[model samples]
Target: MDFDVDDAATLMALLDEKRPRRVTQSLLSGWDMLQTDLPSRERIESATAVLVGTGLATVDEDWGMLLTAEGARIRRAVPGRGLGMRQIPGILGAQLRARGVARADLTLPAALYDAAYSAYMEAAAHREERAYRRHWWETWKPRRQR
Candidate 1:
């Protein structure tokens, strides 16, 4: 399915927050960062679907998801409304890395970028575990012989 503008906007805002980026966490954290109420999970899920479908992000069974190069470019290009400087520079670094760049100057500090990315990876791992447990029985159900 194509990305609805509102969905894309919400995802962009979440990623813009000054913390590790995750579909749900970004939505929850956005409330504090933007001083607005949190968005519903449906909305976040819809946005995530678009991001994944459009190759703007990647979903990991062990990691939540992170913005892809195309996603980062879109986020940088379209700054969120009323949210000044809502682009994550590390995503830019990611964009470069995706293109096989050895080194490049980034708008964000290396230390801050490293911290946020690391935090995101950790969060993704936890999310993956929870998801696995949530559906473990269904996945491990004994298969009937054909």
Candidate 2:
């Protein structure tokens, strides 16, 4: 399938909107907090790389992933855009909350991890489906008892 240019553009626009805000939210977590959050893993990864490459976000020993000062400044300057948190899947939410670290300040690391992991899972499922469609013998073979 062709990549969705519109989806990518939407993400860019959202980031641009946040570029001048004085928000305390990390960009990744902020993006996740959007009601119009990115629709696919590809878009999430691509947008993330773009933000990191542009110095809007950086990997930090303290923060894991964080919006740069400039990024936060830009976000502040932009007119306030309301951000809404995406509802985590029930089981995933429970697991994360159970870990005793479910604070708003910690949302970025959780969001980044969730995005990458979800992308990996989706890609793996796609690969397995393709292999099944192609009639890969291993896909059809009965599993050996452990």
What does the lDDT come to for candidate 1? 0.49
lDDT of each: 0.49, 0.41
Colliding residue pairs in candidate 1 = none
lDDT string, candidate 1, 1-146, tens digits: 22233444455545632243643443455533443444444445555555566566665543355777766666666444654633443333344334432211112233433454455557768989999996886677778621
- Model 2 C-alpha lDDT per residue in residues 43-97, reported as the tens digit of each score: 5445444445555555443334445675445444433345322322222223323
In lDDT terms, how accurate is model 2? Answer: 0.41
User: Model 2, stretches more than 4 Å misplaced?
Assistant: 1-38, 60-64, 81-146
Q: Candidate 1: where is the Cα deviation over 4 Å?
A: 1-4, 16-20, 23-26, 79-146
Candidate 2 root-mean-square deviation in Å: 15.4
**What TM-score, computed on C-alpha atoms, does each candidate reach?**
0.43, 0.33
Error of 2 at 19 (Å): 17
